[model samples]
Target: MTQFSFFSVIVPTYQRNDLLAKCLDCLIPEIQTLPAEQYEVIVTDDGFQITAQEMIREFYPWVKWVAGSRKGPAANRNNGAKYARGEWLVFTDDDCLPDPQWLEAYAEAIVAEPACLVFEGRTYVDRPRRSLAETSPVNESGGYLWSCNFAVKKQLFESLTGFDERFPYAAMEDVDFRLRLVKSGYKFSFVKTASVCHPWRAKGGWNKIKQHREATFIYLSIHAEELVNINSVYYLLFALRSFVNQTVPAILQFNFTGINEAFLEHFAYLYMSVLLWRYSLTSMKSLKNQ
Candidate 1:
């Protein structure tokens, strides 16, 4: 029996107690499989109307619950890390269900690759074809290393300062944080065996699209020159290609659900383009006023 380091599984949640309960139900059992003192689960609630603390006390007495600042995941995660007593900070969402061997796989990886400081676990949706949330934009590896199933040494996480709270939404903040870590020469190890099941929630309509569009605009705003370089010809051509490639396939297959999803997916890009133009105009106006 090889000894493993302690891990704090940090989950940042909003107002999804039902899903959170299911997630903890799956997770608590997995954590308990290891040594009693080897791991702890810390859940930070981001201003939920119905907090899970009562439920946590009743069912998950071993897990730690904390109050969130109601800012976003980045801030919420930072708060969770503050109280984590483990040497490794394992990040996962309140909606994810870890595989039975998830912790064991990570433990094995740490022992096998002591030189590796960061680990990215695999994540997948069972029926990807059923929902838009299970599409291309939702990177399984989460671009670099998803917060939903990745582990980092507490020291490395601290040095990276967790995530940038400036990103107030659940968007590219993970990518942004990962990019910074990559730039800092942190090597990533993909633990294919350490997996988590992230089931897609019900589609939230165009409001969800609009929210993602804003997040895209924020990412674009950071790279303003790239925004300027996206020519109208290329944009139109790409949109046309996407419609034919993505939307047409679903329409041909008589997938009404998929057709609507594909349309919205394309619309997100188009809407973001419009937002970029508006932002550019606003910037120009500010420059003129200056």
Candidate 2:
């Protein structure tokens, strides 16, 4: 064998022991076909909760556990990757449940396309999207390389320094990674059979819009020349498009219950605009100083 393990499945968690338990329950059965050395499961925790560690020690002792950096999920994941001993590094969030054929499909795809360095897996919520307020990271057709279900060559991931530790938030790090991989000229393949189930969350998404904007700005700050649009006009266009697509639909519902989400959308956009302005001024000032 070329590696101690062909695949190292790394999951990042933050105080969600129950969800992690469910995630592992599904994944454990999927790897029973292969011997212990052929595959490894790693769960890295970023929280102070030792229940997860105790649970893993008592029940799933075969799985490897690591302490997170507590800096953020990006760093937590990279720390998990530090302990990986496989040819391929597979990533999935603690809330996800891999399908029975998930690893099998990836193995087959890797064998079929030996030259491919990265693979995007299919993610779906089995339930209907209840409301515009609900959110899930669903990548049905697969151009979206969501971090919850993807694989990369260990060497390439290390070369890119894994996810940018600068992105201390849970947002846009995956997009930044995908952009970097594209810039490096590696072809990406989507493995439709390598599916993972992401439960649709009733939590509203408008709250995350500002964080997304900040993350996007950070990404632009890092790759200004590589990115196409990095101006005030681009931020305006993004806000306009987002309002039309997201908030407009919530407002069109004509229900008082939807008003809160609509209001949050407006507030998030306002917050993002301010952040964009602040980031632009800082960047320009730094450039002048340089």
Candidate 3:
């Protein structure tokens, strides 16, 4: 009989050794008391740099490290999942610090709810947001299954095809997965005891916004039927309404952050709408010609 771990914590990382080191420092000690056979940790690096490799080798040699697919976090996560040898695959980002009782909380929850397969863990942000632009993947009450901290049965993850690698960006991939899971109709238990601390991540810019728009496009395209009632047109109208209702008010107040976000997010929706309209027309034309 082959022995397998009850939980496999798969962390997807990319070119952030400093953050990854701090995360590992907090994560490893949490699992130390647990039997090694019961749990395992795997770090999948997208960058595959020598510094991180050597750091883990010299300091934390017990943890498993593998090369990420270099595509995106979604792909990297899928790559990490391939190496998982546990009943449950718990995913957390490399920048998150796991609470001391994180693994044990999940273990206890599994024992308590033997029928549950999906689990959403709590993600606490350590710092206050300086601006609305400074985003963080924090889930306090657990409706938001932010990829920072969540666990799903290995069987279910594989059955649902894991994170949709079709997403070119990390924007809507998790949302896509969540939508699929919701469609599956399994109630995801929110495990508040299983927690991780995530620092505020300042990741807003024009380029990032554009990438997010692309991902949203793919998400809408894939879920067109499910969202047929309120698809891209509804979002485009919402963006227009936002500009009229919120952006103009923020402009009068002279809030730079609000104004900046309005330009970055609201206006981009109009841009995306035009792009999508053109794409649809071109698709129709190509099909007619063929």
Q: Quick one: best lDDT, which candidate?
A: 2
Candidate 2's TM-score reads: 0.85
Local accuracy of candidate 3 as per-residue lDDT tens digits, 29-134: 5444455668878999888544367778988887898988888989989999999988899999988998888877887787778788888999988875555455
Instruction: Give stretches of model 1 more than 4 Å off.
Output: 30-33, 131-143, 220-242, 277-290
Model 3, residue 129: displacement in angstroms? 1.6
lDDT of candidate 2 over 26-120, digit per residue (tens): 77844544444567899998988453788899889889998999998899999999999998999999999898788877888888888898999
Report the poorest 10 consecutive residues by lDDT, candidate 1: 130-139
Sorted on lDDT, highest at the top, how do the candidates line up?
Answer: 2, 3, 1
lDDT (Cα, tens digit) per residue for candidate 1, span 156-272: 999988888777888777777777788899788888778888876655567767666666566666645545565334455667897887666766555566566666667766766
Cα-based lDDT at residue 102, candidate 2? 83
- For candidate 3, give the lDDT of residue 243: 75
Global lDDT scores for all candidate models: 0.78, 0.81, 0.80
Models 1 onward score TM values of 0.84, 0.85, 0.82
Q: If both were scored by TM-score, which would come out higher, candidate 1 or candidate 3?
A: 1
